[model samples]
Target: MNLFKYWKKDVPASLVVFFVALPLCLGIALASGAPLFSGVIAGIIGGVVVGLISKSNIGVSGPAAGLTAIVLTAITDLGGYEIFLVSVVMAGILQIIMGLLKAGVIGYYFPSSVIKGMLCAIGIIILLKQIPLVLGLSGEMESDRITFINFHEKISIGVIIVSVVSLLVLLLWDEVLAKRSNLFKLVPGPLIAVAIGIIIYLTMGQSGDLALNQSQLVNVPIPEDFNSFISNFTFPNFSALNNPAVYLTALTIAVVASLETLLSVEATDKLDPMKRQTPTSFELIAQGIGNTLSGLIGGLPLTQVIVRSSANVMSGGLSKLSTVLHGLLLLLSVIIIPKLLNLIPLAVLASVLLIIGYKLANPKRFVEMYKLGKEQFIPFIVTVVAIVIFDLLVGIIAGLIVGVIVLLLKSYTNSHSMLIKEFEGKKNLYHMNLAEEVTFVNRGSIVKELDALPQGAFLELDFRKTKILDYDILEYLDEFKVKAKNNNIQIKIISERGIVDDPHSFREFFGHKVFKMGH
Candidate 1:
């Protein structure tokens, strides 16, 4: 395909995504206990491999922050990173099997509200998790930062100064410069912030405020030789297949990674200018392959990351080729300039992520959901708070449980309110009670009760107590009107207004119908 035509837009997008992906790859690796380069390897593979395979218009894959906890736990529980790697590989294989079986539709089982909650939660989690990194503190000290500022002896005022200042600057730039200047349209705000951060870091290094966080530096292990590079790759400890820990780890990875990927794919599609739907089944298969490959090679587990994907869309990617190119850049960077990468400060990278994190969890998003009404807000807020308190996956599960409960509750309440009673001394007549308001959610039950009337039967729909009726139910009634006419069944709608005849879908569905409440 003619790919270069879109390169003008895609290249800038890839660069922005590259910067965004850089820290996450490293931070997630640091969080996961894998060598930082392994994360980079995963990013490359995710972009080049999964990006190429994905049917999504704009999704970027890489080492997922969501997997950090699982990876850390797996490493210790399974006895080593190598053994955990085995589970990851096997997890990939499982994903492949799931894809082949069309299990991707499992994503559809989740309500849209729950999925939105999941994303908002991740955004909050990203912001919280990065605070320590932004301040140059050790995420190594506490994987679970339940309470704010545990200060587990790793906090430094100097680091905090740099982090807070960097975060503020980044935030200010995103708000002021990004909106105020046309410069940001041509050159990204993050790029500008990074350049400024590097200068500030250099200035601080010269003055010595940067020393406390020096240990938090990005380390891309220098490969002494091709053999050494090859040797660095860790293979799965397939022997651990029988181990309960390994199976659990694999299942955890498959489930969490799949959810994140599916939700991200959905969110990314919403952001797409073209609005072409991503094939969830195909996405699972692609992610399965990417994760499998990552696990096989000494790399972190992968997911379709939205931060990078948003950058891709904002930058103007025409196809998946832009994603592939970004991966290649990541690969080339590590191979050619591993040492130069070390020069980039963690604070600078954190600055980039802070901007992205804020964008994802923006306060405005909450307002938008609230505007949609309670049907959307409860799940959204639950997802956000849960992710902030616990982590990504747990928060999503919590939101989903809440969402499903609310759904069932609504169903039960509506079902209970429905009125269907047989008319006394009238073998063919049946009386139905109507609620104040009816919508599509209760359409099925209403239809089922109405359709059960015997052929040649007379039916009376009593809306005397009903204030409002849903259009969907009316549509169903119109269909049944034809059925009643053919089967010699009489239909009567008795309402406070008057008695009404058949309503057609196109012509008179919205007009007033006759109904009489009192005899």
Candidate 2:
């Protein structure tokens, strides 16, 4: 817990995370159909508040892109952005409740396939959303509808040139320059890319036709004075607190934001070089507080974003201080140098996002998932496709459903393996070896296997390897035991503890251990 032990590494890491997070905060707020400044506010709160509260060392919290669709719809449904802030507050309260209830355990239920799919889908969405910006095909920052069909019509040659050069510089810095020097390693590629992009913009501005307009660049509002700057911060309209629609929006935002946060927590922990474990419930509480504060002021809902967390880890952030420092930088930049931030072109930010998107949805990931077999690949692909076609929540639900189906299918197939042994001068032996875990999904298969046993045969039920047997399956076994007795089939159950001879009650046999089974 020595925050300054790694300040040398943490300072540079925080700067890297700040550069990566700034554009994202703005972009996500734009996508959410909220005030652009609100995103920056959320970024600041997420870094300073959540980072200070959360136990995670490397996980960085901020305005999440996953909730953009929900936020956009909620704003429209709630009638105004101010009213939607009420929901954001409610969501934060709900998240705090969830944390206290230890509902963060739900994070463990998500299958790896579904998680992978969610990441891939988000990656694809990022790429799609940035295409218009990168190509300067559209002036609108938040539109996710941009596709190749209309891309050709809105292409700006100057913007395209800037984007290409920025991307190349990023690639060169990341792939080549970083390897050659510690200075390059400390200076993130995105920062370098952004600098190059601004230089290109300034250079190209000398040419009348090649000059980029205000719409094509970052549109951070520059206040004429201190009072005007302070006026940009918005407060929630508490008058909408009684509205049922407001509550509904709150529930949706809380659930979606919590889910995204949990997923990012899991992903970030996996990426940690120290393999540190982040307390899930504590993380939720931190997020809850962060979101509540964000809504009270003028900021979007926040979550532990994978993109930011990954950048933090890659940048060698060793503690939450890096996250807090990044927030401080964001706050200072907006207050002291908003005009300089406004100079950044949208195309440059788009290029940086495109790189992140590529990393997330890399073709190699698809190939690797495919290699994991059909069970993993199907859900992963389904989630990716569903997210692309519908939205983040819908795609994840679709993927989870598919993942559950695959799990059931696996349980059905691997429930038990039957082996018939022919012993000299002995009754025919029917051996059934149960799997490590047997659930209700394996009931039908187990029933069929027991029914297929021949009359006067010796049934050897091996449960030594079985860690769990569902009550439904055990109940079915109890009935099957009676039927086997009538058919003159002798039953011998072998468990990890010992052998069970003609057990009257399977429930009694399982005893106190059954309570801990699913848990």
Candidate 3:
């Protein structure tokens, strides 16, 4: 494919993603309790470095909200931001090792139910986190700390009015204008909302009551000179490398960041219109390099983020160049016109995030999961609730545990089928057909079926269609064979290999060589 053939499309798409990414970078950093510039630095590296290295045509990378809790805690536990950067570097090295080991297959083990739950949970989190900002509340206060009484007291009328208008403009652009005109398609709703916010900031400035204070607006730090801008970049404290806690923190970050990146890759590929597949292992390596560079330069750990990736896809991005362009835009904006960017209201950015969150946590998704059955819906709901109550890692683990139980229950309940046949001038014949997958969970069901067999009967145990027969099931069958002989029941085992007349060879008949050898 000619990568530049879609430049016309990709350029506009990049612009849209840039607008979507800007506030997120700042918000995540604020949430992470790190320097705001670190987030932007990660965004730049994720875009230019990972984007160029990654094979994913549509996937976008940046500072992940999923890592915010981890970073916040690590910074405190590690003693300082510089020390935490050391952990990030070590994490990058670990990610590179994992990639080289081809451990990306772990992504496939995550159930779809859990992944959907994760998405929904993140959506709920984004909504809850942005509510205060949307209502004009500022600072690094936690969402739980903002009570209705305090929220009402702190609400700024000007910010509220601007936010409402910005949200409405976003809806109009997406729901109406984009559908009506091609010009509107080139310009994204987020960009329009931001522009309207800036206009309102200027329009309301003349009236003291309507004007928004500095706290209500975007806080892009304005550097005094070239030296000041250069000074903002921080280097990791290498002395922390000897600390055992640093290694532990690094391992945690590596595992969590890798999982998040792989998850986002899966989500983005599903959203791709062309259905292009991403090389998961290669993507990990790219992310590893990006994180390593980011950590060295005092940036947040980066990952393939679904929110930004989905935005890129929805906005018509067709290649990695769009992602790269967005990074360049972020770099230039911070350096050249940060003051102008600061004019945009935080409320407007919060409105943009609210829309994205609503899309992710749409009620229809829950309805769809419910229609899929309890096997899917239960895990999905559990994941959402768990994430809302706890952190991302805890919520995912809870959902995964629930999903595994459902799988085991299904395996237990549907292990085998039994049939009885009668022939002329012959004793009754019983046939048992094992399910395609017979695990330890199905051992009890199989045993019950075996115990119900009648005496002086001819039995045919069929394993022709069975793919996996557990060791416990084989052992139970071995014991049953001895009892069958005492009951004067003739047993014949049919399998893919052949019929086995000897009971000791039953495990071999089903391809369990290790079990046969032990016997």
- Whose TM-score is greatest here? 3
- Each model's lDDT comes to 0.72, 0.84, 0.83
Q: Candidate 2, after superposition: displacement of residue 285 in Å?
A: 1.4
What ranges in model 3 sit over 4 Å off? 1-3, 138-152, 206-208, 420-429, 454-458, 485-519
Candidate 1 regions with alpha-carbon error over 4 angstroms: 136-186, 210-212, 237-249, 310-318, 413-519
TM-score versus the correct structure, for each prediction: 0.73, 0.86, 0.89
Candidate with better TM-score, 1 vs 3: 3
Question: Residue-wise lDDT of candidate 1 within 1-519, one digit each (tens)?
Answer: 465766666776777688767766776787788877788889999999998888886799998777787888889878998888888887887788878888778766766776666656555655676777666666531232222344475665555665667667666765687688766656655566556665666666744544545556556667877887777677776777788878888888988888888878877887688888888988889999998899888899898977678667755676787798889988887778777666666666666656666666788888999998876788778877887777666777887888876776576457414334556655776666766655567677777776777887777776666555556666677787888788888766666556865434411533434322232
Write model 3 residue lDDT over 355-441, tens digit each, in one string. Answer: 877877889999999999999999999999998888676888999999999988888889988888986544578888988877779
Worst 10 residues of 2 by lDDT: 141-150
Tell how far residue 126 is off in model 1, in angstroms. Answer: 2.7
Model 2 regions more than 4 Å off: 139-154, 206-209, 424-428, 453-458, 463-471, 478-519
Error of 2 at 178 (Å): 2.3
Candidate 1's TM-score reads 0.73
TM-score-based ranking? 3, 2, 1
